[model samples]
Target: MSKRREIETLEIEKIVEKLCLKSNIILRADVLRALKKVCKNETKNPVAKKMLQLLVDNAKIAEKEKIAICQDTGLVTVFIEMGDKVIIRGGNIVDAVNKGVKEAYQKGYFRKSIVIDPIYRVNTGTNTPCIVHLDVVKGNKCKIIVMPKGFGSENKGRISMMNPTSSIETIEQFCVETVKIAGPDACPPYVIGIGLGGTMDFAALLSKRALLRPINLYNSSKHIAKMEKSLEKKINDLKIGIMGLGGISTVLGVNIETASTHIAGLPVAVSISCHALRSASAEI
Candidate 1:
């Protein structure tokens, strides 16, 4: 039998806590830089151009003050890639993740956005539990990524089951239309993540995961790459601008990931991410 390497659950918990605190409470440097670049690229509209600059300035202020970029911090989400050879010795994986979330939110002075109960709606004092997705892969090390999803863009995501006969153009149309309708509500200069195939729920999950891909990389398949580029151009053409005032910096990137699907339907999902795009990953 392969020896199971012991994993320290406390370390995992501590890491998660830090991730939670940093993700929402801090304006990540990468995302901040991206916004500045997009801002500098706009030349046509004065309002949008000014909004972009203001966003940059605001980010600077948040950094200096060590404050959250947005009031709606977000719900905690952790994605874990567990090693097959690892054995968690201290506690349950989910418990460790939850404890980490609680400590991080509390220590970082972030607002607890989680409500304990539905209908009655009581706030969970600390963001005790995160929405965790775990995958056990063939490896001896573990990787964790935490993403705090803001309500604005999360609310705008959509899923659809189209006839399997639906053409690629149809898929593109749905993506573009969804963003168009989202307008400024979902926030502009957004990252659009599209997941096609699988069942409806799986498609939505994949779309969310696709948002984790780096902004600079294009799809691997040439055909898919071209489609992504075309869709990106269309989204930018909407001229939603920095904060939807109208400019050339609306959509920063479009990403699509897929899996084989059933024969009768085309399962599609779109996840919209706002300008902040706060996320971070770590390996141990």
Candidate 2:
């Protein structure tokens, strides 16, 4: 028989509060590395190289000063992998997570961007009611990842329900078109997340999940991996450059996540994340 562990909700809240601040202030390691790598070897284009260097420097200053990497601060989204053998005590998990976010935004002096209603356009003020996705797993430990997603790139995401028989070129076109449409507004030198083979909503969620993957990692399946590389090549070829100044390094990477789907439906979602690509994870 396996041993079960009891954890306090306060512990979860504290961990999440720390993660919220960390994610907002510190750029992900992989993202920072990619920026430096490209900036070092990037083409002779003066504008592109200068922009990439500024981005790299900005990341450094933010972490050193313990300040927000971007003014948006972002909408907090938490993804949790909870073990079934674990028991929660003291309080409800959802409330605990919200309290954590509220505390972080207030303490970190991060901007609160969530609104009470889309129509009313009033700020929630607490950045509470953060979006949470939880999955029950096998172990006793709970893994949590906090992603501060900025709306500039979020608004540019696109989803399409296409024929299952859609050709590779067709799919590539849809994905590439999204980046092209985003232009400079969504922030270039972006990380592109492509989700394929699921229902409409799941596909969109998968795209967001794809952004969580490290920049250099490729999909495991060989065919899928090839497609990812091809798409990455195609996007950089757009020469959107850094902030769309026109250079060879438009995107840092492209990630594709897939799920089993019904035969008639081929749902595809494209999510574009800007250079910051902030996320932090910890297990408890």
Candidate 3:
């Protein structure tokens, strides 16, 4: 039998709190590099180029000053990959994560954006009860990824159920139309995550998970990589520009994740993440 790895709940909480602070304040290096590259390449649209530059500058300032890149520090979303042989000690995992989130928001002075009730609408204040997705894998370690997702871009995400026979062209069109509809609301210079071939909820979750990938990486499948490139170009062609001001550098990247689905259904989801693109990961 494989040796079991025991992890203290406090250790998880410490890592989660650190991840929240780091992800919010420091934009991922890949994302910052992409924005700078866009600024350099967008020669025709000076306004958009300037906006892109500003974004880069903002990231630099946030990192240097140890402050959030955007005022909306965002709701916490944690993805946990647990090895089958790993054991949690000390306390419940979910409670530990929530405690970590509360500490991060309070100590780091991040905006508490969670609401206790969706309809009645009262602020959670502590940003507790973060969205957690747990997956069991084959290792003896735990890996955690934290994504601070702002609502502006998140609200624009969409999912659709299409016939299994739907062509790539149809899927491409749907993605483009989604971006067009999102427009400025999602904050241009977006990172688009496309999830395909899963159940409706799974598709949406996959799309959100796709955003956690590095901006520089492409889908591993050759066909999917090609489609990702094509989608990126099409999205930039929309001229949404920086903050939707009209330019050639609208989308920084397009990532696609796929899973097996029922023969009768082809569910697709598009998750739009703004330029902030804040996420960080660690393994323990």
Q: Which has the greatest lDDT?
A: 2
| TM-score of each candidate structure, all chains considered together | 0.94, 0.98, 0.98
RMSD of 3: 0.9
lDDT of 2 by residue, 1-284 (tens): 45799999999999999999999998999999999999998867988899899999999899999999998988988999999999999989989999999999999999999998989999989987799999999989999999999999999999999999999999999999999899888888899999998899999999999999998999999998998999999999888888778877689999999999998989999999999898999999
Name the regions of candidate 2 deviating beyond 4 angstroms.
Answer: none
Worst 10 residues of 2 by lDDT: 241-250
Alpha-carbon lDDT, every model: 0.85, 0.92, 0.91
Error of 1 at 181 (Å): 1.4
lDDT of 1 at 42: 82
Per-residue accuracy of model 1 over 70-112 as CA lDDT, tens digit each: 7767887789999899888788989999998888777767778
Report the alpha-carbon TM-score of model 3 versus the true structure: 0.98
Among all windows of ten consecutive residues in candidate 1, which has the lowest summed lDDT? 22-31
lDDT, model 2, position 70: 94
RMSD of each: 1.7, 0.9, 0.9
Per-residue lDDT of candidate 3, residues 177-237 (tens digit): 9999998887779999989987999999999988988879999999999999999999888
Clashing pairs in 2: none
